[model samples]
Target: MYERLDKLRAEVERCKRKVEDDRQRLKAAEQKLQEAENTQILADVGALNLSPEQLADFLKLVANGQVGSAGTVSTVTAVNKETEVETKDDDDYDLEGLEDEEN
Candidate 1:
């Protein structure tokens, strides 16, 4: 009977070790997933090509849920392509600089 008990204890120890190993693997997988998500967010924001100040201002606007001049809440949505947001009239922005950059 003691021999049987010893074998059972050994089996329990093996099972515990396996559970600990699985927990470690799960933690690693979660960390990897979080890092990948961060990278994807950075890539998405970087694709906007806005300057640091512009990006900060845009983020603040989004956080505040405000739209331009209307003082209304903004709606967040996903788009597969870049959409042109007409913030100002053509004369408001320096087109010559944009033209220079295009060349």
Candidate 2:
């Protein structure tokens, strides 16, 4: 009877520890899921490239159903800036130390 009682107590303790571990893993997974969702939302918002005031106004207009047709929504133009090209050539170095071997 004592042996059976000891086995039951050990099993309960093991189950408790397992449950705690599972809870921690679950919490981490939930945090990762939330972060991923936030990343997706930020990516979508970033793609819009709207300033804070413009985004807020656009969102408010959309929420209020103010923009009904294509004419009502203002046109947003994307500005393209000229970027400077990197002209550093790493493979063009002159090797001055090596002597030519005559075979």
Candidate 3:
């Protein structure tokens, strides 16, 4: 009986660890999905003016904390300027309103 009890306890602990690991994996997946969605939204809004190479370089610098406040500000300003230039004189499609009307 004691041996059976010990085996059951070990199984329960193993199940608990599995549950925790699954939870962590789910959280990581959700974070990745959010990042992908944000990237898509930026692309749709014509706000992502940086090329893949530029984006990779910027992300590396930011991740390493090598980008100080001034650097951060300048990067943001440059992106905004590019986006403005790209979107200048563009008419709003108002897709949201069109969807609402269709509904």
The residue-by-residue lDDT of candidate 3 on 1-103, one tens digit each, is 5999999999999999999999999999999999999999778545655766556655666677655554223222124323421121113334687779989
Best by lDDT: 1
- Clashes found in each candidate (C-alpha, N, C closer than 3 A): 0, 0, 0
lDDT of 1 by residue, 1-103 (tens): 5999999999999999999999999999999999999999999989988766666667776677654355433343322234433354335666897899999
Task: Return the lDDT, model 2, position 17.
Answer: 100
Candidate 2 residues 1-103, lDDT tens each?
A: 5999999999999999999999999999999999999999999989977776666766676677654454443333322243221222234455454434422
- Which candidate has the top score in TM-score? 1
**RMSD score of candidate 2 (Å):** 15.5
Where model 2 places Cα greater than 4 Å from the true spot, the runs are: 62-103
Model 3 residue 91 lDDT score: 36
How well does candidate 3 match the true structure in TM-score terms? 0.45
Q: Per-residue lDDT for 27 in model 2?
A: 100
RMSD of each: 11.8, 15.5, 10.9
Instruction: Show where candidate 1 strays beyond 4 Å.
Output: 67-103
Global CA lDDT computed for model 3: 0.64
The residue pairs that clash in candidate 2, if any, are none
